[model samples]
Target: MTSHTWRLQPEGTAHDDRYDARADCHRRLRGPYTGLGTLLRSLVPDAHRARPELVAHHAVEILSAAPELKDLIGAGPQTLTSLAVPNERTRLYPAKRTRRLAHGIIEFLHGHARERGHALALRFDRVDEADHTDQEFLAILLRRALPDLVMVTVHTGGTDLIPELTTTLAAHATHTIAQHPDEHEDLTDNHKLALAYVESDGTSHDPAEQAAYRRVDAAERARLHDQRAAELRRSGDWSLCLGAIPYHLEHGSDREAAADAFLEAAEYLVSMGFYHSLLDVAGRGTALMDPAEEPRKYWMLGTKVTTALAILGRPEEAERRYIELRAMFDQPMLHIFSGYALAMLYTRYYPAEQKDHQLAKAHLNNVLAMASLLPDHDQRVFQSVFNRNGLALVELQLGNPTEALRLVSTGLADIDRELPAEKHRLHRSVLVHNRGRVYTALGRLEEALADIDTVIELDPNYPDYYFDRADVRRRMGDLPGALADYSESITFAAPFWEMHYNRADLRLELGDLAGAIADLGYVLELEPDELDARINLASLLREQDDAAGSLAQIEEGLRHHPGDARLLCARGLLALDAGADQAALRDFDLALNAEPDLVSALANRAALVLETGDHRTAVADLTRALAIEADNPDLLYNRGYVHQSAGDWESASRDYTAALLLPGADRADLLRHRAECHLALGDPTAHQADLAAAESAASSPNAAADPVRS
Candidate 1:
């Protein structure tokens, strides 16, 4: 059997035996794999730096030995590099190239091993320290499962592996080894806890382990700082700055430098849409800093932490951090940033009565007031533009669509005039998206669609753009297009309950009842206590004639919200339909007691009263309902029938006349009732006129016949 063995590096240390074996194996395979060791050595602390080139160079060298694989290697160096270059028009994910490289390597290795009639064994020790790009590559390679190759990978276990890496290793690793040391061994408390953390797979609940884990984190962070510094000094690559933050924080050796690194990295990560990582970096960095000594850095770190928390759906934590950061910041720029973050949180997460769009508007106004005091930088103007967009969103949320549109338009004009095109693309795109949302709210679907199209051109992968466009498409009656755009939004960022709910609603409108039911059911599964989703599912079930399923859904909702008037009313309606008059009456009473002005409950209870021959009580309920909605034709018609039955001809005539004047009134029925009333009141001419009008309005012979007098 032909095989190769290599060990991956552990953080803060090296294993010499595995290193020696790697070197020996690459040196022995001099024809093609000579520089494999050199290629591995070139991996820097920054995972994003020229990874594709390294992988491609290694593949090229390997292909030089096997002429049969030349076609697979492609035409030239430019071709290999071009493979790394993503199509900007296609909205490529950041990790796409890493995955591509992994697949390419797997294909090459499998073909080579197969041609040689032997499987190759490759071992990676201490794989935990591999940067994100390398980890992705490893994951894809393992998932591909090349038949002619055997691969082994080892992780240091204490480090928090990304989800993809952890899943890949857990699913594919064939063997495991425990390197846990004896408790009595002469080790530091941090080291002992680190071992325990590793043993328990980071779920150790021991109090000692918890205490040790913090120190271990600090130590590891410091080690990372040392590693990043050394790598940067050798390679002169500045992008490794982000990877150095935790380490610098751990050591507290350079307060200003660490703070600067943290702020820069946090902003870069934010642009890359890595909110979770931004939170980690900002949180760790803020904990290590002295606020008085590094106020600017502290403010920036805290602000970023708040922003990340808000974006990651932790509004309460974001609010707390923002308030603390706001108290610490006397600087105008920091105030603007943190205030805007708070404004967005309030707009999205706060209760309707508690929402502070006015506060958001005030912050933007303050930023504008201080604009002349600031330097003439594009970033300053960009912040102003962003704040205006925030205000527009707040306005939209507050139901001031016209004001929202005006703000978005003025902000777009300000960005065009005050900032250079390249400097404000992101802000402009966002403002355009806000404008689209405003247009959507104002019922201007075509204009909204146009603005969303522009936004998509600027930032196609942004999920909200797709969602907004999906809404526009839905309003425009493009059901398939709306569904596709909704799916696209989910593809970009999945499991959004709002998107699922909206799509289910659209599907129901388009008569895809099963699809609508499935989407609604999935939403309930994700959030079991979602009352609106439960109600919607129940309604859909009833429409499909599944009354039992519908009742079960309403009961489930009642379990979560016992006094919910809407659920009670729904259950009551179902009971009335099933001839459970007592149960129906009880449910309606409960619903009305909880919510006295519930129109549906009032109307339904009146119908139930009419069924039980209590004409006076039925008339009273209908009268109360009509007082609430005086022009409601159904209320008018129902009350007229009750009055006519009780021999009150004049009252019946008044109700019938009112019903006839309302749009969508059953004209033939209303006229016939009025003719009967005229006859009872001994008016021959009025009766004859109504009878003629009723006959003309009626389309059928039976309907044309005069309504029988009670």
Candidate 2:
């Protein structure tokens, strides 16, 4: 048995071009799963030939999503049509797509593994420069793949990686620092070393090579950069435009070309929802040109920077940049862009106390005003509709559903009347989607469903439309319809944890317990620290009488979220079930200390204390629990029993009367308890009447026992 060692470079080393060029590249421009594509080629160079069934079954679908793989495996039929189309409006989130690619790669690896007697060792280099999608894929692979299949190592160049990947690596991988050999002898010829560095697309991490390159004169360095940029350009690799070209151009003498390349990369990243990458590229572009000299490019980059900032939840920074742009350029388009960005900041991204819908509306109004100043008629109309859609969101947040509906309707009407249906299809869908949300808020279920259905028809490949329709159906009490729509959404884009989480809830409602459990387990697989999913999974496991599984889930959730009141309460309930009364009581105390109003903890603690004959404490806990759930018949009945136990006849009578008024209350039990209380109070007439009522209720077929502390 021979063990294979594969020295992979996430951002390739000096000798590699394809992997280096693909670093930080947007998936839309180069297609997704490039990292997995490289891995597949390395692992099984003739995978299609070696494992035709596997390629036909698993690799084809992934290759369809990643066209770059077509050259490696030979292009096949478009099996996953939903993922094949590269529409910015209908694409899955980067994480979701990465998960799908990871699944396919795991399957491919497992298939390859069966032929090998020993596990392969994978060494990933320069992971710090890898794209977020690649990082996400690697993280998922590390977490989900069997350890016996592959041994993995990562080199991060002493830089901080994304938190999730870093955490996963910390837990699953051994940590070691690499010590480079002394290379001072190699720095003697600076010019030759610099040339070699440039030829390598500047991917060298050797200290001596870097020192030699820096020793070269600035003009010579610029010449080298220009040469490297030209070579990359002549390579005709589109991904190089995003990675090596922009980098070399920025360092070269061509400032204008650098700005252009950065702008192009930023736009691609924006379309791909790589907001963090967009911010970096847009910032570089903004630095290359002056707002006054090249106002269009400079402000275009500025707008992208601000938009990315807002989306990334740095609204304050976005607001400051927008203000600076507004001060520098008073152009109508700049104002319109800035105004909309500021409006969205307030409407969606700002902290709760800082959120001001009125201010957002004011900004949108300014945007609408600027729309009229546009020279082109189409531009004017499109800007008007776009800003009006934003205004609809602001109005919706402002608690004016009617106004929001009017705004969305007006925007849709403008699109229909003035613009061609094909011109702004994405924006048109957005307007209709907004109308659906407005309709949902107004309790117009049928109208909401109709609007969502229209959008789904218009853009059937978009997963969110199906998710929206599913929610609407769920709200309309159509569980089967909602479940079908949720399944459709999952089919279009798998590994979206929210869709799986929601589908689990619907499955539970439909009594598909196994399906619900599978969905929840999948959700946890995709997002381990999803607290709600963990809590729900634990509760469901408990319901299924899987005590060990339920306890394990609770412990895992507690590990992730220490002192979480809900998990603590759940743990307490598990303890109570296991007859660990003291442990249950302690957990209830801790949970209530964390959250005073946790009703489950209070109710369970009340039952435990009542069993211990602490009538005062039991009454107090039940009273507190009742405050949170005033209509709960169980709490009322339990409290009435506690008061009767403590010899408070009048209070017991009052509580029994209150419980009898609620639906599902045991009429005979309440009547009997109240009759005892009345007798204790020396009210013979009332006692006799209550006894008669209790006798009649007990004789009825609907009567049943209602135990205390139920």
Candidate 3:
């Protein structure tokens, strides 16, 4: 019991964080299944988390505001109530389901906190007032060994408890405290003082009273800002001094010092990912500098501002400023820097209509030339390798994967030559990962896996690396390995939908229809307009004899895409399964009308017509289907059935023999059917041989089953 920890504290309901945290956790675990693709349904729920690179890419979108970053953001505004994972839709053990939900929630929140560099605190402040189900959830959470999880519970006195919760608390209780009024009052006072000092006023306030009670008029407040700026300058903390610059400027405190602080702060913020703040400082800092006296300072501030604009997704403004900077500054380094930033805008973040890879390549080549002329050898090498990395990305965007891989490989070699082992570790990781991506695109799984393995060893915490490896393993046919990688990705980033979609596909391949269906359903929930997931789910349901479920799903899809040929074809399948032959025929007719070349609809309607003793109509349908798919065994076999029913033994036998020669042929069934045709034609020798072959085929361990494929 000591292995688990549980604490009971009674507090106001409004203060409880557990419910909100639990709700968020459930959403993460359940969100990805909304629009499952056929392939992704096989993975565990964890793989549903967002990959790290996508998240980083999204961060750029937020900082840059560039509307043209072409990537699937998510399944927007879809929900799980209308669609769900198969397990949730079906009846499951209450205890097991609850435990999974609870554990998944904990893991989801933990991963989120880890990625954002924050602490996770799960506080159930008034458990005694909660319902039995919630109480059970708390108990289950306490029982698990969650890493870095802070679990706190509150139980008010005189409240009834469920037996399981009572037993859980008795065994795992860590502490029970009776807080004193004076101690509580002192704690409240400290909180008030801290809030007043920071939130209420960070500068000049009345020193006659305690910090918490200090107040000031507008003039006094302005004086306080000036005073705080002076204090920060005296303290000599560059970072804090920079933070105070805005306040000092507003109060008209030391214009020269404030301008210096602005330049330093903007540079510092660039490294810390405060792109927006960098723009603010650079914008005002340039205005403060006298261009005639300090042209260099003005140029530096302008360049910084331009780069910030580029990174923030304002390519037009950045390009304009870059042109201005080039005209104003003669420094080669500034030109190279501007060229590099502009190149990235065209390569990675350009609007689709504005994409120009040739221009991007030209800019990158300019960087290469400028860097080659640098006095320092190490600096030149570093810049060259960096440009090569960008060029590799541009080649990838241009659909030259082999060229991309070659460039990235060359870049890595340059890094090895120029930088020490510790100096370019991050760049090395990126280069290896990029090379792996190219390998995956080339369908070279072994090489791809090797590169990804190296990447993971270098940076195991990155979720996207795991996602890349999972895809490589899937392509290699190592389903278990792929699934493991997907799970690892979820452990790092819990809001990714692609992982769920991929896992669902793997599960289907492994014959886990229930798991596959669940994943597909979840995918549909995530992406309601995902037609592939809808079709796959309906198809799987038909296999499970869930014709009504299959029909309902198809109908829902039809509502979204009225008269869609594919959905109509799927509906026809469901109607056939339900034994509504007339309705099936009508659906097939409608489907074929929507898409005249739909082979399945033609073949299936032919089979239905043959059953009605209309051989000529069936033959016409089969011939049309066969014309579209000449080697289709199912079409050939169905046509043979029509000929055999009409007493055309020679034609039937010829068609059956042709079907048997193809792959996925049902040998036992074909042989027996051919024997019937031979017997009808009075060919004793052929009939006897076919009968023997059928018997042997049925007796064999690798016996071919009947071709009942839809």
By lDDT: ranked, best first: 2, 3, 1
Give per-residue CA lDDT, model 1, range 546-654, as digits (tens). Answer: 9999999999899778899989988888887788989999998999899987777888887788777888887887888888888888888888988898899999999
lDDT of each: 0.64, 0.76, 0.64
Residue 14's lDDT in candidate 3: 31
Candidate 1 C-alpha error for residue 188, in Å:
12
User: Across residues 577-628, which tens digit of lDDT does each residue of candidate 2 receive?
Assistant: 8999999999999999999999889988988998899998999999999999
Worst 10 residues of 2 by lDDT: 1-10
- When sorted by TM-score, best at the front, the candidate numbers are 2, 1, 3
The lDDT of model 2 is 0.76
The clash numbers for all candidates, in the given order, read 2, 0, 36
Give the C-alpha miss distance for residue 576 in model 3, angstroms. 2.1
Each candidate structure's TM-score, on Cα atoms with residue i matched to residue i, is: 0.63, 0.87, 0.54
lDDT of 3 at 101: 36
Q: What would the per-residue lDDT of candidate 3 be over residues 532-584, giving only the tens digit for each residue? A: 88888888898898988888999989976799888898888887877888988
